[model samples]
Target: MLAKSFALAALASAAFASPLVVPVSGGDTPPADQVTISGITTSGTGCPQGSVGQFLSADRETFTLIFDSYQAQIGPGTVPTDARKFCQINLNLHYPQGFQYSIMKTIFRGYASLQKGVSGTQQATYYFSGESAQCSTKSTFTGPVTKDYTVEDDLTVASTVWSPCGADLPHQYQVPDHA
Candidate 1:
């Protein structure tokens, strides 16, 4: 019995040592309708609505980190016709690091997609439960990085104006990139 217990412990330790690699792509990018903004202010289109760039391991090699929030925009003006019966998506990520937490809030806005027109701003909300850090430094990557993630939103479609005069997504709209 003691030997069996020891074996289980060893297996658990080995499993814990492994970092969770989320294979990302398709799902990370939010649909045209949903909006992705920041926490404090409704600034740029915060992170790729659903783009998972890398693993949020329990061990992070660096202090600062980057994360992407997922979202979707829909309707004739971008505002969900009905808030109560609108959309809801829950995003959860697991880093190899253990117990670190990040928060994501949705910034709903109205705009025209070259395809449709809608204009308004609303705040969508959700809660995510993800694992903590495991590495200290940021993982290095070449070319466009990709990873997989999950999202939950009310699966309802809203009508939108076929033509928008001036439609645009939320962008940092900053002046210039510092060298």
Candidate 2:
């Protein structure tokens, strides 16, 4: 019975394995005009202590979005000169020409400069939140197109923020419980 239960669980999990995709209804083709992408920065993995659940702020900082052809505004104002060294962006894209066949995956890079003297490389990803028909389409049986868009917020330090007191390392210790 235990063996049978384990097999059943495995089957159920496999049945639900699928990649994320956004389907465009009615038949439409990608626009000739460039797509504009924008998003707020979120801490990826190794974030400093005390900064979680907060959206990237424009205060004392500036944000911009750069794509293949154009650079657009993401946040208000300018990035501080000192903080520019630590910003980075990257992207992961999936495109399928037909319903079942995979076409390609592409990666793009972005850079930023800050007023506070901080600069860095970052990864940015794009998502197809919405699409508009700037022009009309002429075919229906063209092909099954699938696109999965996701932006990665991967920024690294361009320059280091100097602390008056050198690096402070942390030491972890365990104490015996009285209970």
Q: By TM-score, how accurate is candidate 2?
A: 0.16
lDDT of each: 0.21, 0.20
Report RMSD (Å) for each prediction in the order shown. 23.7, 25.7
Query: What lDDT does candidate 1 reach at residue 80?
Result: 38
| Deviation (Å) of 44 in candidate 1 | 24
Candidate 1, lDDT over the whole model:
0.21
lDDT by residue for model 2 (93-170), tens: 223332111112222222222222222222222222222211111111111221222222222222211111122211
lDDT of 1 by residue, 21-118 (tens): 22132134223123222211112233323432332233331111222332333333444322111222232222321112222111111211211122
Query: Once superposed on the true structure, which residue ranges of model 1 sit more than 4 Å away at CA?
Result: 1-85, 104-109, 112-121, 129-179
